[model samples]
Target: MQAVWKLSKYIKPYILFAIIAPVMMVIEVSMDLLQPTILQHIIDDGIAQTDTSYIVKMFGLMIATSVIGLIGGIGCSIYASRTAVNFSTDLRQDLYETITYFSNSSKDKFTLGKLVTNLTSDMEMLQRALTMLLKVFVRGPMMFIGAIVIVFITARELFPILLVVVPILAFCMYYFTALSGKLFHKVQKVVDMVNTKVQENLAGIRVIKAYNRKNHQIEQFTEVNTQLMKRSMAADQIIGVLAPLTMFVVNLGIVAALWMGAIKVDNNTLQVGVILAFINYLMMVMQGLMSSSMVLVQLARAIPSAGRIVEVLEENTDLTSPLKPEIKQIQGSISFENVSFSYLKETESVLKNISFHVNAGETVGIIGMTGSGKSTLVKMIPRLFDPDSGSVKIDGVPIGSYSLEHLRQSIGFSPQKATLFSKTIADNLRYGKSDATSEDIVQALQSANAKEFVDKLDAGTEHLLTQGATNLSGGQKQRLAMARSFIRKPSILILDDVTSAVDSISEKTIQRAIEEQFSDATKVIVSSKISSIRHADQILVMDDGKIAAQGTHEQLLQESILYQEMAKTQAEKGVTLSE
Candidate 1:
């Protein structure tokens, strides 16, 4: 509930519209409260006295009141809609910005499926909650209070009946709302599970089909789907009881009022018209209560959604720039001092007490077995995650002193998995350098040995790539991602196994381009293949979480057992230290 209240900040910008909506609702309810009184006058004075003129005047007044109420209700709806939409729009954008600022570990904390659910379904729930907050909560109590006041004017003794009926209805509403709330929390979690399964299936549909596991996938999906259905049914079933329960309570009050009214009517203590008005007032009060109860159930459901969204909104971005930042021009000199890191702080260090330095324009090669933290080491250069124990400096300045945008922009990074949006090849290539021309894109593609595939496409650089570059082969995607980094002309470029998917000939060509064309930039290549990095100015061999060896390739082969084994293995497979 507190998290739900936190969303009120989004409502502040639309406060005027929100205020006007409730005011309009107040007017509408007032009109509704006045209508029955007008009808009472038409019945008691006009009809009972047999005055057609009086009847016509009072009936016209009733028509006008109904029209006025209609207009007010429409205005309330328009303003509430505007307020709700604007609040949702602002909230969606802010949530995305929050996600973007999240630390790498923080992003991993909430997965793709949960974030997608929060942005889409959960946002919709909050929007609906906002709309109901403006409408039902206002009109319900107002109508109830106004009806009670109007009823008391002609039937004062009826207040005792209300004292009994109102408490019973209030208790029922609270009990049912509380019950629905706990059930709805489980319902939202079930929805997340269903969404997670859907994302898993869609992303791995090919794998599932390759293994002929579609039936098994369907069975898994059915199990989660049934959980969602059961939880949703349970929540809805509880909420469904409200309307009937409300009607029963209201009917009891109505029966009590009518029995008392009949006794009074027989004694000539109350007019027939006043008794009718009281009954109608009771019905309107009951209607407003029913509407309020339905709204309470919806609010109960939204509470869980609001809490999930707040979890993201309030997440601490673990990485933060220095308060007084330094702007240092990078010439690619990098140093890591007693650095240790872990994705989760409480977990074992992924990189332990690692110390390294590379001067400007040097080529460094990092080689390790799987899970030896090769990629994690390079990631620190771009400030993707701050080290847990020590400082990483670029050009003698601590990396955190520089803003994230400025720091990352200075480094060209090609990750292990290549990701491309649905855009033209030129667009993807120029993602890092938006103003790059076709010639620049072509040169980058050629440098990465990827221009051959681009040349084969009908539109060349203009050819449109499918989402995730589905049409491209694994090697092609890696090369294109490499080209994108190349077009940036970064001071530091890190390639993490970018050539793993390519053939030997293309891999050799890319390695050659790195030496010949990108020699001006500090190039750090992380690879499992010794042949790919054997000619580097310095090669680092990582074992466990520590740098086991660092030297020229020939130096490591002589002095390091891990390097000797790696070189021996690759040489026997027809790959050598140098051609």
Candidate 2:
């Protein structure tokens, strides 16, 4: 209910339609109730006494009223559907906006599959609930109550049967609702598991095929499908029992009404017209109750779905910009003062008490074995994760004190894994600057040594890349990713082993381009190959999440044993070091 309440702000405008549709429903129901009275009059006053003209007039009036009611019902339905769709659209948009604000720490709490399910399947459930509630929830009860009133007016003696019948039917509805609520919650969980399994299988089809694990993958999917089927069957079984139980009670009430009404008519206490009207009212009441039961079943399904959406909406983001953060321009100087971090506090730190500085326009290189926290260290520069105990400063101000948007805009990052979207080359390069000209894109591609390959292609800059850039080779993808960062023209550029995919020639080409094209920008390069960072003005060797040595290449070769061993290993492997 809280989730619905929070969404009410977005949905409130359409609530006027909710109100209008129900009123129109009541009008239609009123017309239906009036038809039974008209029939009673036709039988008693017009036809019984042999007045043929009055009977014809009454019949024509009934037909006209029926037509009016039908038109009103149709209009109400159209209005309700339009409003419901717009309400759903607004709800989906809000959910997307909320998710976009989630920090990395908050995002880890949900899987991609589960989020997708919540946004689509869960929201659909809520939309169905809203549409049904507007169309039927109000009308069902109105018809039930109105029919009872009419039954009392036409034949008071048969009305007591409703007291006995209504409670029994209500109790059946209550019991089924309680059981179905629990079952539907389980159904949603099973659905999430199925979605997760399918998503994983599709995304990793290459690995599954390479290992020839088709049978294994099929078995895994079948398990989840079976679980979903079992839960759905259980819910259906509950509904199956409840539906017949309600019908049995309704049938018993009808038998009682007829038997009692017949005695009254024979005893001259009631006329045939009255008895017929009473029976008509009873059927209307039963139908209204049955429709109400269906609404309850749908509500049971939607409540849990709404709860899941609320959980994500209520999550707290660990990394939020300060209320009044500094908004100054970045000058490329960065400092880490005893910074330490861990993904989890109980585990060993991914980055230990590390301290370093890069003055304006300086090139600093970081080299370490895998798991030495090279990527983790650079991630903090953009505040991807806040340091545990110390401050990271940009331009002598603590990074946390800077606005998140301002800080990120000032630094260009190329991740260890080069990710590209399914778009044309021009679109991908222009991602850094939406208004970038073709010349800007050409220059960026040239700087990354990607211009030659891009120009040779049939479509050139307009060539469409497949998802994850699967159409391109590893080196081509890396170079394009590097071009994306280069076009940003940021004050600080952090490349996290981005050149590892390319050969030495291409690697040197990109390095030379960075040095010459952006002479004023400070660069931090993280690499595994010693040759990649040997020409850096200063190099830092990291071991076990801490810096083991820091100096120029020649100084490190002479002073650091680790650097010397790394250089010797590369020499023996026939990899030449940059002078």
Candidate 3:
């Protein structure tokens, strides 16, 4: 609930709509309150006196009030909707922007599905609740208080019935709201789990089919979906009981009033018109109670949704540019001084105390077994994840001294897994350099050995890719991803196993093209194949988070036993540099 209040600023921009909605609701409620009094005049004054003209006048007044109330109701709804929708839109936009700027370490705290759920389902809940708050929230209390005042004035003797009924209804509302709050929170969490399962299965559909695990996937989805159903049913069942219970208590009070009024009429102490108007106001009170309960239920669901959203909104972006960044001329010289990093504080370091240097325009190759911290080492240079200890420097200055945007802009990184969006090939390529020309694209494609295949395509660069670029082969997507980085023509280029999917001939062609195109650019290539880095100026053999050996390929072949074993195994398998 407090978390919801923090987002009040989002409503500030729509304050005019916010103010107008409740004001319109007040007009509608006031008009509605005037109806029973008018009905009393028609019954008591006109009908009893047998004056046809008087009855017609009172009926006309009642019609006019209903018309006015209708306009007010429409106005309230329009303004309330505007406020809720705009508020949600603004908040969602800011949330998305915040996520885009999140550091790799910060992003790791949430799953892809969880973030999507927050952006969609969770945001929807808040929007609905805000709409209800502006409309029903204002209307309910006004109706309740207005009915109570009317009841006291018209039938003071019967008002005591409401005293007993109101307390009982309030208690019911309080108890059920407390119980349902916990249940609704659980329902939201289960919804997140359901969404997560769906997202994971969709993203890995090919893997599941290839592994012949469709039945397993279905069973997993069913389990999560069923959990969601059970939690949702539990929360809805509690809310369901509230309406019936409220109506029952209110009806009993109306019955009590009718019996007491009948006795009064028998004694000629109360007129029929007065009692009829009193009953109408009593029904109004019942409606008010129902509306109040609905608001409470909405608030219950909104509390958890708001808290989840706020958790992300208030998440201290663990990484940000310094207030005073020292921008310097970058020449691509890279250095790591005793750098060590671990994803978690208590976990083993992925990269242990490591020291290395690469001079400007040098090509360095990092070769290691799987899980040997090859990717982690290169990621540090771009400030994706700052090391827990020691510093990474570029051009003799600490990387932290440079703004993240400036530092990252100068470095071209092609990650191990190529990520492409659902867009035209030209659009995806331009993601590297927003204003890249057709000639630039062609040159980059040639450098990445992607030109031949792309030229054969019917649409060429205009080809629209499916989601995840699943329409292309793994090697083709990797080449396109490499071409995007190549288009940047960055001072320092890091290719993290980009050639793993390519055949030996294509891989060799790509290596040669890289040398031809990026002759002056510092390049760091990570690979498991020795042939991929055979012609490197320096090759680092990584063994369990530490650089086991660093030297030229031939030098490591003689000095490093790990490199020797790897080279001998590849040779025995008939994998050769010439091939």
Winning model by TM-score: 3
lDDT for each residue of candidate 1 in 95-125, tens digit (9 for 90 to 100): 9999988877786688877888999999999
Off by over 4 Å in 1: 157-160
Please report the TM-score between candidate 1 and the true structure: 0.94
1 against 2, candidate with superior lDDT: 1
CA lDDT, every model vs. true structure: 0.89, 0.87, 0.90
TM-scores of the models, in the order given:
0.94, 0.94, 0.96
User: Candidate 2, which segments miss by more than 4 Å at Cα?
Assistant: none
lDDT score, candidate 3: 0.90
Candidate 2, poorest ten consecutive residues by summed lDDT = 2-11
- Per-residue alpha-carbon lDDT of model 3 for 249-363, expressed as tens digits? 8889878988999999889888788788888888888788778878888888888888888888877875678888878767899999999999997999999999999999999
Of 1 and 3, the candidate ahead on TM-score is 3
Q: Best-fitting candidate, measured by lDDT? A: 3
Off by over 4 Å in 3: none
* 1-579: candidate 2 lDDT, tens digit per residue: 676677667668887887788777777888888898899889988878899999999999999889988977886787778778898898888788888887666666787678888899999998888788877887778878899888877778888998898889878888887898789889999998998899899889999999999999999999999999999999989989987888888889888978987888889887778767877877788778877877888888988888888888777777788999999889999899998999877899988899999998999999987899999999999988899888899999999888888999898898899999999999998887778899999999999999999999999999999988999999999999999999989999999999888988998889899999888999999998888888888998999999999999999999999989888988999988874
Ranking by TM-score: 3, 2, 1
